[model samples]
Structure formats: C-alpha cells, structure tokens
Target: MAEPARRRPMRADARRNRDRIVAAAQEVFAADGARASLEEIARRAGVGSATLHRHFPTRRSLLDVVFHDRVEALCAKAGEHADRREPGDALVAWLGDLNVYAAASHGLVSSLLRDGPDADLLKRNDDCQAMITAAAGELLDRAQRAGAARPGVRVEDLLALVSALSLAAEQRDDDEGRANRLLDIAVNGVLLPR
Candidate 1:
C-alpha cells in the first residue's frame, strides 16, 4: 500500500498565534503558578479563550508545549556552548544559564520534579540532565588532561553541586552575588591542588 500523505505546514498566521500563546503562557504561568487561568493567557495572547482551547484543550496540554519548548532551547544551547568554548567552560556557562532560567520560570523546575502523570516530564528533564552530565564529563576530562581539575571529580557529583548551589542562590536576596559565589565555590572545589 502507498504511504499516507504528509500534512501541510502551518500557515504563518497560525504559527504566529501559537508562538504568541506560548509566550503569554510562559509569562502568566511563571507569575501565577500552575493555577494561572486560561482566560488570562488568552487575554495576554490577544486571543479568545475559545482560541486558546482550540490550541491547548487543557492546562497540562499548554504546559507540555511550553515545557518541550524550553527543553529544546536548553539542548540547543548545550550544543552551541560545546562548540564555542572548552567543555568545562561550556558546562559552567550552561549551568549559569540554567539557573537563570529556573529563576525566571518560578517553580516550573520544582513542579517537574514531582511524581505524577507528569512523571514523563521529569524523564524528559533527565535527558537534559544527561546531556549536561556528558558535557560536564567532557569538560572535567579536558581539565584533568590539563591538570586543571581534581582527578577524582565525577560528573554526577558536579551536577549535584551545581544544583545545590543554584538552589542556594535562589534563596538569597542578592541573587547575583550568590550565583557568582556559588559558581566560584563550584569552580574552586573542582580545581586541582597546586
């Protein structure tokens, strides 16, 4: 039998609407948490609630779209960073970006960590973690090859350290200072002894 025909690409207008909706939802949900209303999202997107429903029938559907978009962006950033900088440097830079993203998204990361029907969301999140781990491992290997980093440092340990540091940074009123301090401590801890 012949294969089924491929669907046509979305029209520019439809694509614009979708992008607008996602942007609005990102802002609304970040500010208002998971209970952010669909009507508010539609208003922010300059679309009707019916239109929002047409695109995303439920809040989870909208969240899935927004969440996937963020993951793809983070993955792409990791690839770009890997290309543009030394592995360790790239990993460090990406960690900073991830912290900023987490801060801006406001509880999105924590919610993903929770178990539920959204457990798959956490699994997808693990893909990003694995990518970061691989990148960090490569960087650590490079630093080790250069005698710049401690020989025994593991990628998982480094990731855990960064996560803890980021959480600590988030708690501080002087977040920028805290983030810098966290990064400094992370870098220092990974450094080889003279």
Candidate 2:
C-alpha cells in the first residue's frame, strides 16, 4: 500500500496567508461563484496576487482546499456525534450536521460539476467522498447494532436522501427550517419500530 503524502508544516506567516486566502476565496466563490477572480480574492485576503498564487496556483486548487476543509470539519463533527451514548440520536444528530455541511457545499459542488475538474481536484474529491462514507458507515453500524435503526440501511442511501433534502432546502426561502424538517423525516424513516 502507498504511504499517505505527508504535509510539510508551513511557516507562521505563510500559514496565515494561506488561511486568509482560503477564507477570502470561500467568500468570493460564495458571492460570485467559481469564476470569481483570483486577483479579487487576493485583494480581499489582504495579500498580493503573487502570495495567493504561491499558496494556490489555480482556482481549482483553491476550491479543492475549501471543499476538503469543510469535509474534514464534518468528519470531526461526526466523531463527536458518534461519541454520544444514544446511537440513534447520534446518527440523527450527525446527519443533521451533515445536512448543514451539504448546504454549505452546494454552491461549490455545483460549480465544480459545471466546470470540468482537474486531476488534482478529482483525486481530492474522491478522498473527501471516501472519508465521508467511512464516517457515515461507522455511525450507521453503531445505530443498527444498537437496534436503534432499521436493518438494511446503507450509508449511501442516507447520503443520497440527505442530498435530496439539501437540494430542496436550497430552493426554499427558509432553508434551515426546511432542511431540518427534511432531515427529521429521514431520521424518522430510519428508526426501528418499537
């Protein structure tokens, strides 16, 4: 098996610059979509274009970082939810959190799909999906083992169901309310009968 690539620690200033650029890029992308200008992002980040380019050479690279960071954060939240004693409640809570992540990810995901992804973006996308799937699988397993969830529920099924909810929520004026309602429906459907 291939060893995972090690990330070298960045110098303090470089790390700060990178963080600023990513934050700016996310805001710009949210406001202007993926075609948002890199120079504009650098300006918003309080960094020069050269520095932005040094950290993220391509628009796709910046998007990849933003997407990966969000997924990693979701994974962390899943870990927290999994630690809860009530397995069903944990799964439902994690899925609710996942719904929020999905909503945040909607714009970037749409842009990435509309534009052809580069090799690096595709690889990162695959890795992010794998991480999310693994987290969901663990939570689902716990719920099922506890007899809190119905038999035969799969992680992909939950993901797809939540994706639909997220899409529906995106179209609503009260997205948070709609998203939570949709997630509640999904959780109810998954729960085992008494």
Give each model's whole-structure lDDT: 0.72, 0.85
User: Which candidate number maximizes lDDT?
Assistant: 2
Q: Give the TM-score of candidate 2.
A: 0.86
The digit string of per-residue lDDT tens for model 1 on 47-108 reads 88888888889777888778667757866776777789865566667766765665655466
Q: Quick one: how many clashes does candidate 2 have?
A: 0
Measured with C-alpha atoms, the lDDT of residue 58 in candidate 2 is: 78
What residue pairs clash in candidate 2, if any at all?
Answer: none
Worst 10 residues of 2 by lDDT: 115-124
Worst lDDT 10-window in candidate 1: 110-119
> Cα RMSD (Å) per model?
3.3, 3.9
